[model samples]
Target: RKGITKVTVEALPAEACRVTFELKRPWRWTPGCHVHAYLPAYSLWSSHPFSIAWAESKPKAQPLEIEMEKIASKNGSLSHSADIDHRPNIVTADSTYSRKSMLGAPTVTTISEVAHRKDGVNIAIPRDSAVTSVSLIMRARTGMTRKLYEKASASKTGTLTTWGAIEGPYGGHDSMTSYGTVILFAGGVGITHCVGFVHHLMLQYQAGTSSTQKILLVWSVPNTEALEWVRVWMDQILRMDGRRDVLRIQLFITKPRHRGEVISNTGSVQMFPGRCNPETILKREMAERIGAMGVTVCGPGPFADGVRGAARSVVTEGVVDFIEEAFTY
Candidate 1:
C-alpha cells in the first residue's frame, strides 16, 4: 500500500480532482500508461483504471524555480535557436513571442518570465525531473470516484488524505517516438492519457533520442475551466527544453460562457471556440507532415469514433497508423 499524499478537488461545477500518491519504491512508466487504483477507504474491492498524468522524482540540490530561470535565460527566444534546422515548419499564432524578421534580431524573452508576467502562476518543478510521486486527474462519477470527490469536497482544505494501492503500470504498448510526426486527440478527461506522451516526446526530442519532428495535441473540452485539469502538468511541459520547436497545442472549447474566456496563451499554444473537426485537422497536418505519421485518440465513444473515422479516411493517402485507448471492465 502507498501513502495518498493529497487529493485536490477543483472548484464546484467541475467534478475533476487530482490525486497524488507517494510510492514506496521508484517506478518507471511510459506515456499513455495507466494503473488500477484501489482506495480501500472509498471502495474495498473495486479498483478503477486511471491514466498516469504526471510523475516526478525527489528534487536535487537546487530549487526548481532557480533551475527554470537559469534554463529560460539561457535558451532565450524559441525561434532562432541552433537546432531550428532540425525542426519542422510549424505555423504558430501571433503573440509577443513571435519571431522577428530575417534581417532583424528577434527580441529575447524566456518562457518562465512570460508565464509569470502574464498568468501570475509560478512554473513548478519539471514533470520528468524525478519519480517519487505520481498524480492522476479523476473526474467524479458514480462509485469510488464520487466518494473520493465528496470526501475531499467536505474537507476544510478541499483536500483529503488516505491510503491507496496501485497495480500494473499497464497499457502504453504503442510508442510514438519512431514516427516523424505525431498527433494526439484528447476529449474531456481523456487529456490525462495524452499529456504523458507529449511530455515523453518533448524530452526525447530534446535528447535527440527519438525520430519525432513534430507533435500536435488537439484537445476538446466543455468549458474553459476544464483547462485546470492539466494546467500544472502543462506548465512543466511548457518549460521543457525545445518545447516550442517541437510541440503545438490546440484547445477547442465546445462550450464557452463568454467570448473573452477563450484566449491563446502563447504562439505555439492556442485556444478556439466550437468543436474541432477531426477530418479537417488530420488533413491539415498531413499536408505538412515530415515523415511517417502516427495518430492516437483517448476520449468518449463518439469522440474516439470520429478520430478513428478521420484516420481511416486518410489511410490510402500515405504512411499513417492509428491507435485508440479503451478500457474494458
Candidate 2:
C-alpha cells in the first residue's frame, strides 16, 4: 500500500479529480502506462485502472541551474555573468522556468549548447532522472471514483487523503519515438494517456535520442475548464528546449459558453470552439507530414472509432500507423 498524498478537485463542472500517489521507492515506466489503483477505504475489493497523467522525482536541495552552470564551467562553455542573465531558462524533470529569454537572443547559450560536443551535434552525457511519484486524473462517474470525489468535495480543504495501493505500471511497451511525425488525439480525461508520451518525446528530442521531428496533440474537451487538468504539466512541456520547433497543440472545446472562452495562446497552441472533425484534421496533417507518421487516440468509444476510421482513410497515401488505447476491467 502507498500513501495518497493529496487529491485535488478540478475546476470542471463534471466533477473531475486528480489523485497523487507517493511511492515507497523510485519507479520507472515508459510513456502511455497505467496503474491499477486499489483504494481500500473506498472499495475493499475493487480496483480501477487509471492512466498516469504525470510522474516525477522528489526534489533535491541542489538546484538544476547551479548544476548546469557547474557542468558548463567544466567544459569551458560558461558565459559571462551578464550574458548568463539573458540565457533561456532551463527545465528539468522536476522543475520549470520561463522560456521568454529565448526570443531573438542570438548570443545567449542554452544548456544543450553548453553540454554539446565540439561538433555541436551530440550531448556530452545522459541526464540523470528518476520517478518517485505518480499522479492520475479521473472524471467521477460511479463507484469508487464518485465516492472519492464526493468526500473531497465535502471537505473544507477541497482535498482528500487516504491509503492506496497500485499494481503494475503496465502496457506502455509500445514506442512512438521511431516515427518522424506523430499526432495524438485525446478526449476528456483521455488526455492523461497522451501527456506522458509528449513529455517523453520532448525529452528524447532534446537529448537527440528520438527520430520524431514533429508532434501534434489534438484534444477535445467539453469546456475550457477541462484544460486545467493538465495545465501544470503542459507548462513544463512548453518550457522545454526546442519545444516550439517540434510541438503543436490544437484544442477543441465542444461546448463553450461564449466566444471569449475560446482564446488561442500562441501560434503553436491554438483553441477553437465546437467539435473537431477527425477526417479533416487527419487529412490536413497527412498533407504536411514530414516522413512516416503515427496517429494515436485515447478517448471514448465513438471518438476513438472516429479517429481510427480517419487514419484508415489515409493509409494508402503514406506510411501511417494507428494505435488506440483502451482498458478492459
Candidate 3:
C-alpha cells in the first residue's frame, strides 16, 4: 500500500494527462510491482494499482517519482478527481493491501529509494529531464480482497483477492539477452515495460557481444493520450541506433485512429490499431522462419487477449518462442 502526495501533469508530445505522483520512498517496491492506494478521504481504501515508473534518492540529490493517470471520472465522481487541492472524502492512496495495511498502514516499513552510505556503495545515475517509462511496484495481497473492495465505497466487507508481488527493475526478459533477431509485441503500457529490454539488448550490441539481435516492436496503444507519454521513450529509442537501424517499432492504435493519420509523423513508430489478429502475427512470418525467433507482449485487456490468442496458435504451430508477462493471470 502507498500514499499519494504531490500530483503533476507530464507530457510526451501532443498528449498530456495527470501523470506524476509523489510516493513515500524507501518502501520496498519492484519495478514491475504496483502500489494499491487507498483514499480514505474519499471513504475509499481500495488500492489503485500503479507501476513504479521510476525512483531515485540513491546517490543523493535524487528524488523519487511515480506516474499516475486521471481518467474521465469513472464512479460518478468528477469534482473529486478534478479537485486536487486535497478534498475531504478524497483521500488518495494505494489499495490497502500491504502487510501493514492488511494488518492495519504500519507505523514503520522499508521501501525502495537510495542504496546506503555504509559501504559507500551507491548507484550513479545522471539526472535528466526524461521520464523514459513508467514502472509499477505491486502487492501480493490475496486475502479478503472482496471485503476490502466492498468496504471502500459501501460498508459491507466482501471477499476479494490480489495475487501479485514486488519485483526489482525490469531489465527485461532473459530472452532479450539472447542473440538472434527479436520480434517484440508490446500492447498499451507494455511499451514502458520494455525499456530495460530494448536498452540491454542495444548495450549488448554496442559491447560487441557478437550476437546481433534485431528487434521489431509492435505496439498497440489505448489512445492518443497514452502515446504522448510514450513519445519520449520512442524518441530515445530512435537515437540509440546511430545508423537509425537499431530497433524497428510497429505501433498499432487500437481505439483511436483519427483523420488518416495512422501514426504521428516523427518516424517515432509505425502505427495501426485494432485487435492484433493472428493474421497480423502471421504476416510477421516468425512462425514459418525457425531458429531463435521469439515473441513477447505487454499491453491492455483486449490487446493482451489478442496476443494470447494469436500467440497461443503460433506456439502450437511449434516454430516461434512466445514469452508473456501477464498483468492479471
Estimate candidate 3's RMSD in Å: 17.5
lDDT of 2 at 23: 77
lDDT per residue as tens, model 3, 1-329? 23344333322322222233433344332223334444333324344544444433332232221111233244444444464433223323221111122244222211111111222211111222122223332222343332333333242332212222222333322535453656666665556455445554554665566253566667666554455444433433344433135565565666653433343333434555464564466446654343555666666666666766776665655445666766553
RMSD for each model, in Å, please?
Answer: 12.5, 10.3, 17.5
TM-score of each: 0.77, 0.77, 0.51
Candidate 1 per-residue C-alpha lDDT over 1-329 given as tens digits, one digit per residue, 9 for 90 to 100: 34444333343337878887677776666678788887888899788899888776643344355455566578884433435333333532223222223345433222221332223222222333436667888898889888888888887878767777787678877768999999999999999889888888877786788899999999999986677677767766776667778899888989877675565656788878899999999999999998999999999999999999999988888999999887334
- Residues 1-329 of candidate 2: C-alpha lDDT, one tens digit per residue: 34443333332336878887777776666788888988888899878999988887655344467776877778877744635553454643421211223455422211111221222211111123457668889788899889888888778777777777788788887769999999999989999999888988888898799899999999998976677678767766776678879999888989876665565646777778899899999899999998899999999999999999999999999999999998334
- For model 1 the local lDDT of residue 234 reads 76
Query: What order do you get sorting by lDDT, best first?
Result: 2, 1, 3
Looking at candidate 2, what is the lDDT of residue 225? 66
> In angstroms, how far off is 316's CA in candidate 3?
6.1
The pairs that clash in candidate 1 are 56-130, 56-131, 57-130, 57-131
**Where does candidate 1 stray beyond 4 Å?**
1-13, 59-130
Q: Measured by TM-score, how close is model 1 to the native structure?
A: 0.77
